[model samples]
Target: MTMSAVVMRKGGLELIETPIPRPGPGDVLVKTLANGICGSDLHAVTHGAELVDGFRAVTGADPFDLNGQVVLGHEFCAEVVENGPGTRGTHAPGTRVVSAPFLLREPQPVLLGFGGVDTPGGYADYMLLSEDLLIPVPDEVPTDTAALTEPLAVALHAVNRGSLGSDDVPVVIGCGPIGLAVIAVLRMRGIGPIIAADFSPARRAMAATLGADIVVDPRETSPYDSWRSVAAVSDPARFGRQTVSFPGFGFRPSVVFECVGVPGVIQQILGGAAPCTKVVVAGLCMEQDTFYPTFGVLKEIDLVFSISYTLEEFGQAIGHLAAGELRVDPLITSRIGLAEVPDAFARLADPEQDAKIIITPNAR
Candidate 1:
């Protein structure tokens, strides 16, 4: 039998029919229910070679040769249909689940979706999942919501990177899916007065809905001004101490999430932040970013870079969704079929388009 999948070629995406794969020993064959289009997916299709080169430069090895095609999708949920030979587990067929995309074949890590033709991903009718990586979705969590487990885990990990305090004023500079996820998780942790900045009005509105106490358009009004006002009321002593002030602005950020990924944003944060602030970088910036070292040195800012989440973090993401602690419904802007994936990918390139687009492979 054949299944439809969205394959990433040299420069674009194509919906192709491929043989339905059977799981090997210690593996499970999953029927894909929902797969979310990620910002990384957008980067992969648009800059396949560059991404591959960057990965190779960092890891000193390539998971897959960039010369070949690969299926794209790491954030997804599926139903187990068959447990492969020698698969030892209690999970039976028809169990809804999600898994970490990293598969450990040897001692090294192999990415499921981006690892080329050998390890296909969830942008298809079915995918082969490693048994150890599977995490069952609760009955209360819808399939669409469960599909967000991966990205939410990412957000959780990013948030964990920051040292958040009860009275610390948090700021998020970017209202993309990751930024919104950060806001949601912070709210769950009871962190308040989150100041979010974005150029897009729709994203700013979404940030407001996702528990951002204050949302500002970077193009119109500086987010620094709004956050400073709140910081003044929160900590008045900083105003009296001129030594820690930045250009006479006594307000300082406890932690700032740089989710924008573009250049200069980090510099902007460093320039405005007070001394000893922590700035977490969660965005996937492909190119080299230049920031003013003098500002970072003067502020003594702690720039922390976050990557993938741990298995425990992934489970916690599902728990939050099941417990209704995290908001997933509002993030979903569109549901598409396998055939529409190419167009959907293109549509997501628009800065003003939807937030999250889920691909339902089984849907007609």
Candidate 2:
């Protein structure tokens, strides 16, 4: 007997029946209840972002061996249907949780899945997760809210990189789900004068609700200058407002976070650095190495890259959702079943939608 999975084929994603995996010793079998449609999933299908590793290996005289493929989701929540025999003091029956989704190959191994890395993910009915990678979902958190654990963890990681000060003016360049999340988490941490930039009015409005002090629509104005009015160093020519001080030419930020993963935006982040500012990196991409020497030499900026969250952060994020400390209900715009994934992908890929689409795999 088998359950079902939403399988991605040559040109599109489809639903298919597959074997229900049996958990071996030390394994945890999860019956997936909900999974978030991550931005990385959009990149995976369109920009070839998901195949960065396999894409690299096949280039320049390497074995063109394309191997295994599985379901496609990383931001998710599941129930422990079957726990392995050797797993004592572990997740018992009826325990629901969110998986880190890594394969758990220890000894300081490679990273995989989520938005940043390439790995098989969780767009299915029943999936296999390592016992260690599973974090308990709080009882007060609904399954859909618990599904947001991964994105919230990522947002927390980005905000933590700020070394955030209470009065510091923080700016987010992209107001996607992750960007809005960064906005939400930064406010929760008491950082103010937050600015969120994106081309969509809907997104900017959403960001405003998420606690952003100002919203910049890249479609109408430059995000950099739009933020300048709020920043101490206001450029009168750009903002049409005077009486604001500049951090000095070639100024860096106290801390800056880059949430939009584009090559040009990457350069902007490096260029926008203020002296002694820490760049809390949070974008996902497969672009080649891009950086300029003058960026560091001219500004004396600190560039730091944060990949993913530890289990502790995951737990904290879950607690926020459970306690209603972090408001995510406004972030989630739509809920759909397995059959609607294709159309869902199309909409999210457009970059015009302001809401995060969550998937309910168990919904029939």
Q: Which candidate leads the pack in lDDT?
A: 1
| Segments in model 2 whose C-alpha atoms lie over 4 Å from true places | 54-67, 103-120, 226-228, 233-253, 271-276, 289-291
Which tens-of-lDDT digit does each residue in 1-364 have in candidate 1? 8888888777777888888887777778889999999998888878777777888899887655555778888999999999988788658999999999876566665687775545678898988888888899999999998999999999999999997876678889999999999999999899868999998888888898889999998888777677777876545654422444454645544788999888777888898765767899998887878888988877667899998898999989998999999986889999999899889988887758899999999998
The local distance difference test score of model 2 is: 0.71
Model 1: residues with Cα > 4 Å off, grouped in runs: 233-253
Q: How high is the CA lDDT of each candidate model? A: 0.84, 0.71
Summarize candidate 2's per-residue lDDT along 111-208 as a digit string, tens digits.
Answer: 33331112234677776677877788888888888888899998887787667766556778888888899999988887767777888778888899
Candidate achieving the largest TM-score: 1
Model 1 residue 176 CA deviation (Å) reads 0.9
